[model samples]
Target chain A: MTVERSAPPTISEVAAEAGVGRATAARTLGGYGYVSPELRSRVLAAAERLGYRANALARSMSTGVSHTLGVIVADIGNPFFAGVVRGISDASRARGFDTIVLSTHESLDEEIAAMHVLIDKQVDGIVVASAALGPKTSAHIAEAWSRGIPVVLVDRAVPGLELDAVVIDNREAAREAVTALIAAGHRRVGFVWGPPIAGRPDRRRDLVDAAARNLWTDGERLRGYLDALDDAGLPFDADLVMVGEKTEERAIAEVERMLGLDDRVTALFCTETDAVTGALRAIRATGFRVPADVSLIGFDDSSWAAVMEPPLTMIEQPMLALGTRAAEVLLALIDGAPRSQPDGAFRHTLDTRLVERSSVAPPSA
Target chain B: MTVERSAPPTISEVAAEAGVGRATAARTLGGYGYVSPELRSRVLAAAERLGYRANALARSMSTGVSHTLGVIVADIGNPFFAGVVRGISDASRARGFDTIVLSTHESLDEEIAAMHVLIDKQVDGIVVASAALGPKTSAHIAEAWSRGIPVVLVDRAVPGLELDAVVIDNREAAREAVTALIAAGHRRVGFVWGPPIAGRPDRRRDLVDAAARNLWTDGERLRGYLDALDDAGLPFDADLVMVGEKTEERAIAEVERMLGLDDRVTALFCTETDAVTGALRAIRATGFRVPADVSLIGFDDSSWAAVMEPPLTMIEQPMLALGTRAAEVLLALIDGAPRSQPDGAFRHTLDTRLVERSSVAPPSA
Candidate 1:
């Protein structure tokens, strides 16, 4: 299994062979100022002979900027992240910056690895859309900031991080979606929730006790749904709630099990597009017509939502805007602009609109 | 809108400010071989005052290697490419290499842009899955070779380019699929062909033109179908032929239009999974029973193909193997290994297999 190692030679070796002081060899090999042609030739030849390659990390330590940006996402397979990546790529290209994209897959270790990679590469800035931030990940980003590398949080915000961020108002968007469903006459609505990992420590506690107290996005959304229900004089039914894993198959199975209950949900509110798709498939399998046997509403208006049979009623989040704004902020930081927020907590809240489609209707009698 | 530019300081200014000869300043700032500590300190102080950053591209030209890899794909949105990219990332990460991924969007200009970016970045190597290559693109890769940077062609093999490549036998796979259809008593068969584009030139012309000449994979598959038809005394009819753009919408539309023809197609063979999905949608739309009214077969046994309703019968290409092999070849080239082939054209073709499922059956009366 062993392949020939193609590792580049070390700087010390190149210096020794170049027959010059280490400092002189370093500067000449690195293409820094003040190297004569003869010395430059000697150093380059020696370095080439020794296969010495310049280390970008060391170079970044000397210079304030690395001309590289780090982009971290929860998952690459999700078309949402893919679209955001496209936007980042376009923006970064326009700014003549290169990006190092990493998929965290919702793992803290992976997120940490991504941060380390970016730090090692000495990226000028970092844009992250994490599931949640661990203390270590937060510390790593803070360290990079101390070294003058700007970090911009995207989608997921880490509380107390004091970094610029671009995000949609998830709680407001969710509440609006739930309010719409309630307005459409859904009395008994079930919810499919996302993983309860909060990005900030202050928010983490709220998320942990979300079932008891109002969390940021999820709790606020739930409160909105409840408020709408209360406004309609409908009692909130706990039994109607179903929590499922994010995968389509698992979500569908959870929905099927929930539906088999004695008093099944009359309508459903999917917290994410994946949940929506899964619920639809399960309902279809049971021969239930959308908005007939059960009305449904979903968050995140994904591309496939419009193409699905009966289409889909969804709350659309501005994914591209979020990505573009994050890039702009990072570029601004790279340009040595004053931080937008004195507290280092810059946030942008985008409006979400509900797209009414055949997937939602008054609950059937 | 005009944005403020934040360009880094140049090396020449750093040398002048350091009060040293240009050669001395370069040697001191570059951090490689030899310089007095006093001279190094003065050079560093000057560089810090002026904010000088070395030009990586120019440095890469003088040196032999750049610690970067370029990756080009026809379409990043395709789940297949996503899977391949995942493999590439995993492999590249294990070796501590950074990759710059580019999407061609099936356009030649974009593909050329990808090449130019990699060249400008002075990347150590490149891996590409091109839509088509003109002389210019070929020349760029050859130029990289002359500059001692390794290039590995992935999926697409250019015949004229003396480079290493990883690919699958598309024709043989197609033939196998058609042969399976023949085995299942399908005679009046039709094909949904891939778009006419040469992603690589070194590939056998017959294979590349299989859909047109009906010679390599496309042709061989057609031959297998023809053999089955001739053996069953079923004359090949051109009326059943349908060509579709790469999109599922177009494929479905083409299939629907072909079904409206007088003769009608009894069985279908699609060249790609997207086309197969489209054909299935069309068949369902027309209320036709799969494998009963019109049997079907597809290429590229995608993850969803097997999970679809009735499951798909398809030819499976070794996707992960293709990616891994391409990486291996590029890594080898980066290690300065001599070309395996004397003429410098190295190509490896993996086998493809037919996976039978519920999609194919004899045509109904």
Candidate 2:
């Protein structure tokens, strides 16, 4: 049999061939309303004969709803963010929402720009896991809100703005992790912190017996650490505390330096995944074994943590709950419910738990 | 000095204190609309006195465009998809779009549901990296198109559907990799393929034989492999050909079984990243060094491929370009431009190149 040789016809050509207006042809061929059955049949026949396909772009513009959801994340490479995004997708699909994802690369400007583009496209709702939330960003969101849009904040919280937010109890989780380490016969431990924000000031002070700088999550987590230490009757040592950036390389380097100092830390208390991964890698590279050469406790129970050589001991954040709760709250607000019930701030904080893994152990002599 | 202990003020309380209508006070304090100077000052004063924080959810429903983009991917854990997402985010942010991400988990039902929910929310456009596309899915997309929504397909393509799509030359890349093995003086070569799909009948034939199948990508790549064998004057061995699912463990097991057969293959061609990683691990586990015992070639030059103990020789796809092009095309189409010039099927194919690493070498006798 000879192969069929003919180009597919265009929508405009089909419209012209059928002697109908472009709009009529678009409506008829696209299977929409307001077209006479006779004219619609003619348009359909012409389209079939000419092999015309309707343009998706034009159709989307007229509909107003693109059947797409915009997801803004700090980074896709981070396994934690990846898991949360996965959870969001699963939940959204269950609710009939197609997703469009954008990564901010931890830039405030990029995050702001993404917001504008998604808004211009008129996305149904926005779910943001932002790294930095400045005053301008908050104002931009406020503008969208005034226009009757729905937004949910995931992972991180904006200080002043009141939006539907999903987050784990960072302070309580950190305190419990440190408390566990102390219970396991460890007194001296090092802490790693996140960005300095006004919402968490005590965490910074709890790092060392120093003045409290304006920091939120980090400070609260640090306070939990201190509370645990005080409860255990252990004196917090300034020399054992090191506060700076959070990453594997930086944490590893800091740990190495501290280990080489006159008074070395007996156990490690890492507040982030990066810090924990770095500490483990550093310990391995130095030919030291976990819980044998040094005991360790970490935050954020990521997937890789469990699969690591000596499975990590960490605080497990309720990731799926965070996404589901955020979606539910945002949907509720979209349905026009009062922000509060004449009681208190409409804030919900999910609890976190400590998971004992192979990484943590009794203090090494 | 006594620390101040008082409850925060409510929105209605602020409205009463400001002596303005509740709606006007809510609008002003919530930053939803334009307010008179005198009224704005009064509302601000009242809010400050009441310590009122505007609710994000309430504000969003009042706004039309939520300043969000919806992103859908198959699996976020897959580093390849993760990288593409990062590129989309980077480009989107540069253009000012906030992203909302969802994962379909390779389910068609989830894909359809996601589309519906996003539509209900009124998203501007959608970018989808679909798991698999069938006629029903295409029809659903056609419905969305009729409504004037823009969609950009990434990594995957649907036949007989007119939409903007971004894809790398998978077949050519696979063929080139196989050809390289032949050039390095390997006669007996084994093959590892991904899961077979029924919708792609031609692809199945290409996997079996080129003359009968004629799939654009798989056929071309299979032809490339046969071309190398033909040029080398090596007889095609049917027993050496093997097809298996795409997974590290499965690929490794298949390769091991193939190796156990009498007079087994001397070189291998892996068409997917998982298969390649599995083959590498199996080779290492078997105590056979790459290019020393049995030569190998991999498709898709992922980060881990380069960082592995012995760098992998593989095909490098233009991943970022694929996403950017898809976005640009969808945006153009949304702007009322024809899908293609001359009103016919528009197809664009990108070139793939082989990066020579240490993974390939002549077979050892």
Place model 1 in a CAPRI quality band. incorrect
What's the lDDT for all of these models? Answer: 0.66, 0.64
Highest TM-score model number: 1
Ten-residue region with minimum lDDT total, candidate 1 chain B: B199-208
- For all predicted structures, in order, the TM-scores are 0.68, 0.61
- Candidate 2 lDDT: 0.64
All DockQ scores: 0.11, 0.16
Fraction of true interface contacts that also occur in model 2? 0.28
Q: What is the Cα-based lDDT of residue B345 in candidate 2?
A: 39
